[model samples]
Target: MSRADAYHKMLMSVSHFQHNIALILEAKALEASRSSQWLCHHLSAAQFGQNHGEQVKRSVEIHDHVLDVIDGLTKMEQALAKNMQALLGEPEAPDSGSLGDMLPLGGN
Candidate 1:
């Protein structure tokens, strides 16, 4: 494959990765919000210190950790997007072009 072909292929893969990460990040944000709401609702029913709250707090912490992971993934995807954009240049027609057109092996 030529340099352009290799560059395009890498760009396509990185773009796909970035898109997937974005979707995952959205889902994670929703999940974290729900978990936080649940934790707060459950904790508010109780008075002062109580063992029941510990489980809810732990659940919220777990969600927080997952959010942290998602945050890391988001950063990675951003870096990939920047590098891919620099490497591939801007889209000529605001379209990614079909795989059949972009592939080096004649879309095989």
Candidate 2:
């Protein structure tokens, strides 16, 4: 390819990354909202059954928020993988980062 063609291709890659990132982010937000709503529904139902105490209510709130954040992060990661595939124009292996290496095996 000519220099101009190469430059155009580079620009296209960047554009694709930006567009896909936006789509994924929106998806993440939607997924998080759905999770929060579902949690709210179940918690409301549980509250109707009996008085579980303040502890239960507080725990439910904390769990709901944590789950929502985690689901959104998962969506973000999956979206990034899809974006990588698109940019490569082919199917590629997933990238897995393992933290085991960072931990000490044993204290001698």
Candidate 3:
């Protein structure tokens, strides 16, 4: 494909990735809030329950990890989008840059 075509396709891919990451981030935020509320409501019970301490800790940790992952993805998506914008003028480097091997538009 031509350089212009590749650039346009990469832009489209970045836009799609941005939308997907936004939705995922929203979902993660909602889940984190819900889990936080649940923990607040059952803090005492979870801490003192006969056999729920570990479960509570694990559940909270899972939610926290999810939030971390969401944040990482958000940052990655933003960086990729910026690169995409830069490539608008440069038509991106293919078959050379390390990212070209992993990104959708980078595949040959």
RMSD (CA, Å), each prediction: 11.1, 8.9, 8.9
In the range 1-108, model 1's lDDT, one tens digit per residue, is 999899879877876877887787799779879977986787563553567777678768777987889688767865675676578675433343433244544322
Residue-level lDDT tens digits of model 2 in 3-102 = 7797678768767877986787799789879977987676664555665676578778878987987788767656765765675677643343332235
Q: Of models 2 and 3, which has the larger TM-score?
A: 3
Clashes of 3: 0
**Best candidate, TM-score-wise?**
3
Reference-based lDDT, residue 105, model 3: 47
Score every model by TM-score: 0.51, 0.42, 0.53
List per-prediction Cα lDDT, in the order shown. Answer: 0.69, 0.69, 0.73
List the candidate numbers ranked by TM-score, top first: 3, 1, 2
Pairwise TM-score winner, candidates 1 and 2? 1
Among these predicted structures, which one has the highest lDDT? Answer: 3
Instruction: Please write out the lDDT profile of model 3 over residues 27-46, one tens digit for every residue.
Output: 87798799789878877754
Q: How many steric overlaps does candidate 2 have?
A: 0
